[model samples]
Target: MANSLILSYLPRGSVVHKLTGTTKLIVFLLFSVATMVTYDTRVLVVFLVMSLAIFKISRVHYRDVKLILWMAFVFLLLNNLFVYLFKPEYGVEIYQSRTLLVQLIGPYTITAQQLFYHLNMTLKVVVVIPLALVFILCTDPSEFAASLASIGVSYRIGYAVALALRYIPDVQRDYHNINQAQQARGVDISGKDKLMDRLKGSANILLPLILGSLNRIEVISNAMELRGFGKNKRRTWYAKRPFATRDRVVLILGAVIAIGSLIFTFWDGSRYYNPFI
Candidate 1:
């Protein structure tokens, strides 16, 4: 049960884990926006390094998120491949320079500009993934909900987010149990089985999973309603905490990074850092 959970908070008592949820959420938003707003390789590399440092501080092991990281890599590779396939000259258009490295059939020529653009895009993904994983793995759902509420988000919405995060592990556990039970009953869901047979077995699992999820949702809604949840415009959060000095410092640093990134990226009237200049 402990090893199977993904995206649920782990209490490691690390500095990142000890920080108030509000600080983490706000800082994450700032860094994410800053990263997406800039195409400067310098800034992106700095952000990537900082993100990795923070991930290390959060005490999350690579082995814990190995599957997710691999999935992200695969998806990133496919996305770049498709982008190049559809618009092989997009980088040249953006950078206003073209240096052909290799000529390929059907207008699919490789160029330095294309490779550089792809490198920046890949860095964005790599930078953001570590920060996001740290946020998800270090934050408790209850505290995250309170953090959202502190930022003036609706309590109902905050609670919904909390529930979703809290339920991810439960859903995985349920699916595992159901898959095991079905296999015991002769449902061939193993990879050694034919693809069609596996699909059928998976379909059989989906029905029960959906029904079970709906039932759990209904029960939760009824419980909340009976307890007079959402009866007022505001509600007190059980996990709310006051911001400490560290929280304030982090938030200030986040603001500096965000504003500095904007200035660095656009002061020259363009987001791209043109080495061809």
Candidate 2:
């Protein structure tokens, strides 16, 4: 359950957990937009600090989100590499200057401009990813569905989202159980095995897991049908929550940050702040 915290809620009593789910979702949306749309290093640095602070406030341990963050780090690294490979001169064009660092193959020379651009690009993800993980970790799926409904989204869609979030942990638990059962039966899926053999063994585990998931899905669908789900124009949420003062404050802060990002990024008629000049 702890290992599955990335996609499942922790049900903690942290300040982040107490806020309405809608508020967190809105803040995530606004925060993501604010960070992504601006390239001001000062702005991005501040956003990064704020995001880290929020993650700490959420009280989710580093271990709870380490896998997701590490995965993002790998992806971010690859993205930067691919960008440089495809467009080595993109930063030079954007910044309108080039301070050469190393001359590599033909057009693949490393430059100060490119590194600066990539640094800002990486910072955007560094800021947003943790905040997103915090939101998912702290908010209960049922309350999140209710929050979605409160925001004028369809209740059916909200319920579906909640079910998806709930199912991640269920699938994880199922996988662990099945793995243990198979391992006890002498099936070697351990890392000691050759990579190919381990993959082959995994297929055996995957087939049963998939079948179990299908069975669970069928059961859930039948239960929903029996309860006349989707028959009403609007359904009520079991964990419906209203926005309190704290939630309002969070919402307003996100809005202000988003608006401020727009102003800072576009005030000079460009999306970047070039301190290199």
Candidate No. with top TM-score: 1
| Poorest lDDT segment (10 consecutive residues) of candidate 1 | 1-10
For model 2, the superposed segments whose C-alpha errors exceed 4 Å read none
Task: List candidate 1 stretches off by more than 4 Å.
Answer: none
List the candidates' TM-scores in order.
0.97, 0.96
RMSD of 2: 1.3
Q: Give the TM-score of candidate 2.
A: 0.96
The residue-by-residue lDDT of candidate 1 on 212-235, one tens digit each, is 999999999999999999999999
Separate clash counts for every candidate: 0, 0
Clashing pairs in 2: none
lDDT of 2 by residue, 1-277 (tens): 5665457788779999989888988888888888888988888999999999998888888888788878998999899999988999788889999999999988898999999999988998899888889888899989889888888999999999999999988888888889889888888888899999899889989999999999999999999999999998987777878769998988888899889878988898988988778
Model 1 scores a TM of: 0.97
